[model samples]
Target: MHPLDALDAAAHLAATDPAAAISSLPWLSASLADDAAAGRFARWGRSSVIDENVGAAVLPRPLFDELHARAGLEAAWPVGNAGLLHVYGYLLSTTPTPYGLKRERWLTGDLERACGLAVAALLPWIGAETLLSRATSAASALLARPDALTEEAEGRTARIALGAPLPDGTAALAYAVDGLIVTMFPVADPAAVRAGLGAPRLRWNAA
Candidate 1:
């Protein structure tokens, strides 16, 4: 099945059965428990690493380990190579923040710094397309709303795409856009859906 079609199916499940939707993600299926995933996302909504001085995002270590394992990366990537910083940056950018902390802080502070560092470190080995795809997929899972195809979501997706070193951001944008479109419009068979939509026009810095 096309990735977007898969996302549509996931979103359809999310409408009535959010747990099923989350569990349907291929990358997340093995290690992450459904209840645990929900709880962890809830913690992300309630907690803040800013006031806590935790140095890392409030996400649990085991969850982070699972994400890395799914990505086929070494454990040392998170701590030694600053992969956690990249994860934190993606989360801060895509996920909603608590009221007290300024979104600007996350946008301008360690979030951007960490993302840049992550791009520099990972791009050489993984290439930009894979890096952005995995990062965005992980972020989409963390947000627990893979169906959010809003302008803001698209913008966040664009930021992630632009962070990579791809020769052209077109494919990256298409992947993100297609994911959003599928989530927003969950049809069992996407051939008709894709025919209706024509093709997703690259909306983010296609140049």
Candidate 2:
């Protein structure tokens, strides 16, 4: 499917069932991407983003207003960390082996489903990636002495231009969810997703 189409479909899922979307990765990313394209963060920015892109309203009319409102503000419109973790638990709630990461058994024709499922799973990662890209771009621009950078700041913006944190080695599940969702759904943050299965309610044991 076309990338945007995939995103729209995922958004449809999210608009229909946000709780289910959070449980899956693919849906999360798609929904986030759609929402990001809209004017969710337009307020932070100096532009009207929502109206510019009508795709944000693809989902059922019921959620358009609320989602748009959420996006308008800089608040975490999409489910928060705990909600995301709750869904992640079900998606990766399978048996835990020596490795901490739980593995899922892929079924036939599940690639698309898996991709859909990964929307939520990978949004955090994708958001981090975007932040990294922006930071790198900003840093590069700063190093290049762009108009945005003035001598008054002494390139401090460039110095603090670290990209969003990625879940490379640490328990960056929060960041991971954002990055992973974007990776799959192709959206930014504060967006929603959908999944068929609910995340399992497994208890965590301390070491």
Candidate 3:
């Protein structure tokens, strides 16, 4: 299984799409080598990202998605902080196999996470702590800079760089500015990727 094939494949129990094209001792540095050549990720950037999520589409698609409305209403939490692994079908289907951060043409994935953050503000700490604790944890990510370049922010905190790393080690990076946090992954090179990979499904293109 190629490293980037995981880019297209979705959640499954038997998915064995490799993370690297060639196995290396330190797996982190080796990840982008293959995918970069094949263009698995649409962009690579180092912005003070506020919300970068892998399977961000797949990560939170179910919650705000109309399909899952019944389940969210039925289940105790999870859609927010109080979610439970279904112990069967859901655990397998929920996660996707993409390291690249994506924007749902319709922002389906973000809805759940935004709701999750709103309900429990403290949950953001989970990834931030992990990024601080383990330097290696963030090395392989799309927006890999764990620390903000700017020394002082405008207000409250020293600086704000919001990140969310899933249990799988795939994470999202968010930038905090003007005392506000927004969730759009920045692109390093606009020409490298397909035009609409990160753009809205319906967008105005200059004629």
Candidate 4:
């Protein structure tokens, strides 16, 4: 099954039985509504819930991991490597708009930062033609950037450098339009992710 299919299924199940969904899935409820508001009944366990004092949404990593695992995705859909990070970043950073070209709220610094890393990770490996099929039209539209490259080879080697690290160890990689696989340095530690394998470069020669 496709990864998106699994995501859709999980979403559907969540919609049907929210309580059950939370129990079965990996998600934490986030309240975002304003409690001071006049009168509004809040829905529990909703991805996006609005109430008087606050609105809440569910932002959890387990959901992403479970959906990816269920989809039975192959190398073609490596959510772990990049897709998952991107999806998480987008959900947290952007607000859902009915007709906005880019559904994400670009203003949020944290979301923007996470998105920067996510883009850097996926830029090189993501097959353009492939993305068109998986990512929604709006996703594709917003994802479209001048820096995105297209080529048969070296697609995975593209590197975008997110120089220096933020207090939270966040950074962005900027790659040339050419082609190269830009590996996403793990967010856990900047130094660990940068340790090059140092394996001697291999070359093919006809004997």
Candidate 5:
């Protein structure tokens, strides 16, 4: 499937079956892991630490560039650490791991910082009220429906690419959903699929 088509399909999944879409996160991460183990996932940059004291996020250059370009903002603009954390938190939540304890610690430890960065990064585009509203709604829904996280669904797989370049001018991040391989920088377009479910505009601050 085409990249946008894959994106749209994922969006449809979120709209029709939010629980299933949420459950598919683990499979998506698994697909990413497989690609990474084979070196095919280099397009998605390596994970790095975000230092709150310095108020800077260490993101992949290409991913950063894509976000900047999409937002139509200058390179000098600060990337929102809270936004970055939100992205990370989502990833952590979706990751398939037996180490629930470790995951919980990591999320709870830095959730506030991540949310702050997210607001900073996204506030310009969506405004503070909208961003907060969307973020809260999303968090509430996911948290309220724990059963959604455990349900299973089935569909064919397609590779969808996000509109970002790697440092080497290759693809950025791509994951295999049930019927789509979604290629997108989560930071650039956080909660895009979920937003399609009438959540809110999670896409970067695009003016």
Candidate 6:
């Protein structure tokens, strides 16, 4: 199973069925737990950080760690990976549109900052490709700039072909693009996804 398999499944499902996406949360969280325990993702237990000082109620890390431990953990949204997941989860579930794309909101400063940690912790070692995938460059860019994300020319987030690597050296990008897809939501097309994501197309070695 890919580290991000659960997330990708939810993304595609949200494209059509958000109820299905919400219903799948327990299963998704369980699958995510397995993946984490498998060591692809280190234990994502609660962090000491808190974002309550601001108006945004980030899912508390302790609660996230608890609910995250099993498929059963549920709580108010605080600021952490679970908060990111929860925001997307609600948007994906309640929307009538595919992926709730047009409805997606840009994350607040603290939440966006939290994603910086998630992206770094989640990104895997990708191999060089003859022509690198969009994610490689995007990942490089997101690390440098959190507010800027991959968007299509029309300016909606697009899925940038990031997923499980082929296990061969040419596997391309990894956990990055998939994370952004649902975390960010749709723009217009894939090409713009790469462009709005910020970062000039650099050679794999250069990236």
What alpha-carbon RMSD in Å does predicted model 2 have with respect to the real structure?
18.4
Candidate 1 per-residue lDDT over residues 1-207, each given as its tens digit: 864455446544544554455456553343233323333322211112222223334333444454444434444423311222232222222223342222232222232232333423322112333323334443444234343233334233321121222222211111233223111101223333334543344331111
| Global Cα lDDT for candidate 6 | 0.32
Against the reference, the lDDT scores of all candidates come to 0.32, 0.27, 0.26, 0.29, 0.31, 0.32
Q: How many backbone clashes does candidate 3 have?
A: 14
Error of 5 at 38 (Å): 39
What are the per-residue Cα lDDT tens digits for candidate 6 across 48-141?
A: 1232223232333333444334433433434333322433233332223333321133221222222333322222211221001222233444
Number of the predicted model whose TM-score against the real structure is largest: 6
Task: Find the candidate with the highest lDDT and give its number.
Answer: 6
lDDT of 4 by residue, 8-78 (tens): 44445554443344343232121111111211111100111111122322323444444333323222222
Return whichever of 4 and 6 wins on lDDT: 6
Better of 2 and 6 by lDDT: 6
Model 3 agreement with the true structure over 20-41: per-residue lDDT tens digits: 2112212222322333344323
| TM-score versus the correct structure, for each prediction | 0.24, 0.24, 0.21, 0.25, 0.21, 0.27
Rank candidates, lDDT, best first: 6, 1, 5, 4, 2, 3
- Put down candidate 5 lDDT per residue, 143-202, tens digits, no spaces: 333232211223332233332332333222223233211112322232453244242221
The segments of candidate 5 whose C-alpha lies over 4 angstroms from its true place after superposition are 1-49, 52-58, 77-85, 88-133, 136-207
Candidate 6 deviant stretches above 4 angstroms: 1-33, 43-66, 71-77, 82-92, 95-98, 101-188, 198-207
- The residue-level lDDT of candidate 1 at 103 comes to 27
